[model samples]
Target: MRILLVLFLLAVGCAGRDDGEGVSTQRERDSVVGASNLPGASGVRGALRAADSANARHGRLDSAGP
Candidate 1:
């Protein structure tokens, strides 16, 4: 009875603690560029432009292939 109560309390405490592995440092997070970093329609346009530029560059290389 008391042993079961103690076990339950231990489990509850452990579940709420962060083991530190899930946390990201400021520098680590800053190095990532995700969609959340961009704001509205302009962000979408910027992403499309970058994709198009990459595709054009790839096409140029492929055209020169053996």
Candidate 2:
């Protein structure tokens, strides 16, 4: 009875643990590099470009005073 309980607990623990081996496939790595080279890729230059375009289209809003 104790052996069965121990084996059941062991199986449950092992089942809950992932090996964490499939996080970085070759296609995923290539996609990450490709996106980094894109125009709006969340870096400083891209953020500045986005802000500039937004300001150009809408003009700067006066938040401090009406």
Deviation in Å, model 2, residue 19 alpha carbon: 54
For model 1 the TM-score comes to 0.39
Clashing residue pairs for model 1: none
Runs in model 1 deviating more than 4 A are 1-39
Misplaced by over 4 Å in model 2 are 1-42, 60-66
Q: Which lDDT values do the candidates have, in the order given?
A: 0.70, 0.66
Estimated TM-score per prediction? 0.39, 0.26
lDDT of 1 at 14: 85
